[model samples]
Target: MAFDERALVRGPQPAVPEIVPYDDGWPDRFEQHRRRIAVALGSRAHEVEHIGSTSVPGLGAKDVVDVLVVLDDPDDEAAYLTDLERAGYELRVREPGHRALRETSGRRVNVHCYAAGDDEITKYRLLREHLRAHEDARRTYEDAKRALAGREWPDMNHYAEAKGPTIHRLLREAGWTGAL
Candidate 1:
């Protein structure tokens, strides 16, 4: 099934993403959430990793921490969903192989759930690693992101969608041959 946005989401339109300069505190923020998530879900969290622009040092981003929570079976809600909710993440997207949640306190945090061995998960890692290791890729991505930030978007998803092409290009440049 397609993903559904059910909670902690804003109105349907004009969601402007403000890309901010890289903050030294971003990692700490992610670690704080990661620890809480660990206490909430325990080993089922498999891996609680920092993803997205905020994960990369020196890259400007929307200031939301993107977290990747790898689960053995993301579609099995009974396994980890309620626990995550209890920990403060509100479900935001539910789809075939993944789920998305956000911090309930309006803090800038997004949690993505994906099953083990999911190709998309690998993409996230690859993109993050590429940006970290390559200065040129990071600058190009940051430039694209800044260019797209603050424009009117029907949903914050649109802002993310606008950055897709650049991401794919960078991914290719990184020698990833997987389907886009």
Candidate 2:
């Protein structure tokens, strides 16, 4: 399905949520969520990776941990959600063609589960790895996030799109030619 890319760049929208930049406790939080999700997904879950800003140390973020889970069969997410609910994660957003994503009770996480061979997960990993490997790019990304956090955009997607140009520039510099 095509994402509403315009949801970010066009007209007036709802006020963006407040972004709280925090310390490196984010990864620990991700680990906590990861273990629970892993147990919930069982064998169907191939791998769970920490993505998004919180995964990067010293980066100012919206205090959310974005995780990507690669599953053996993406269609079998239902089998996992039952256990996920038990583990305190709630079904938040549904992007049918991409992945079945969930959020934690505290609303501090975004857990995305996709099929094993999906390039979405790979792309996320690649961008993350690229940022991690390049100090300049990482710093640039952090600064951009900090600056954008101050602007009151319509929503998280808007905020993300606002950072798109900078991110894309860095991506190009890092030789990241994958889909964004």
Candidate 3:
């Protein structure tokens, strides 16, 4: 489903993302969150994997660790949302087919939840893997990100939106042709 503003739990907030150099600690952070999510959801957490720029080694990102958790049914929030909350995540986005929660304290980690078979899951993996294997693509993406980060934005989403073209282009280079 399309993203709805109403799905935003904390409402809109202005942002000029601070994209930083790749950190050697990013993978550890992802693993920490992954473990916490696994324990919280138990068998419900079908799979938990790291995604996004931080997941690709030597790639600069927003200093936030991005993780993806595949659930049997993410729409049924009652099943996993509270557990995540109790474990220190707050609902950030709740669009259909997907949900996003961020670390309540530092907001350093973002957990993107999706139901099994969601196309986004595949897109994320493809891009992450592609970026990991291709140094040139990773450099191109990191450069695009640093350039975009220098501008102002009404919302963090805008910064992300600005990166769409570059992202889709790289995805296509990775052979992804699915709708954005």
Candidate 4:
């Protein structure tokens, strides 16, 4: 019989590690995760995109690739959940705000799956794009994240929440008039 290494690992899994800032390997890391998700979801995914600090060069980040797998039919999310589960991602949480934010966790990956046409993707893209083009915004965002990482909230959500001020401030400066 073949040995299943993952099954042999015991105990409740550890929490995702603290943010590690920018690393040169971030893009390749995202590519590997993207391929895995793409193979698993096949046609169900309209697109899997990199949309976070890791996607922007020279920006320090949490060392995790934030990917958005956009599905065409919002009502059919339940169907894809099973496939995602099979792909080694454990469902983390579903955003109460729009129901479009579904977080998943893997050994080294944190994925936020959203429905196509959802504003979540748009906001992420806009923020990421704006930050990439604007040096001041990138530096400010990086400094804010590092400061929050030092505090080290109980989990990722709190960390994200703590960074909201910087995010909002940048968005405002970028002329993002809130989620369109």
Best candidate according to TM-score = 3
lDDT of each residue in 153-180, candidate 1, tens digit only: 8677667877889999999998899898
Tell me the deviation in Å of residue 11 in model 2. Answer: 17
Better of 1 and 2 by TM-score: 1
Sorting all predicted structures by lDDT, with the top scorer first, yields 3, 1, 4, 2
Q: State the lDDT at 169 in candidate 1.
A: 100
What are the clashing pairs of model 4?
A: 21-61
Model 3, residue 17: displacement in angstroms? 0.9
Model 1 regions lying over 4 Å from their true place: 1-13
What is the lDDT of every predicted structure here? 0.88, 0.69, 0.89, 0.70
Best by lDDT: 3
Worst 10 residues of 1 by lDDT: 1-10
- What lDDT tens digits, residue by residue, belong to model 4 across residues 2-102? 22223211312323445575788888888987898899889988898888888988898776677778776544557676777787776555543222232
TM per candidate comes to 0.92, 0.80, 0.95, 0.80
Model 1 TM-score, 2 decimals: 0.92
Residue pairs with colliding backbones in model 3 are: none
Global CA lDDT computed for model 3: 0.89
Candidates by TM-score, descending order: 3, 1, 4, 2
Model 4 TM-score on a 0 to 1 scale: 0.80
Candidate 4: residue 149 lDDT (0-100): 72
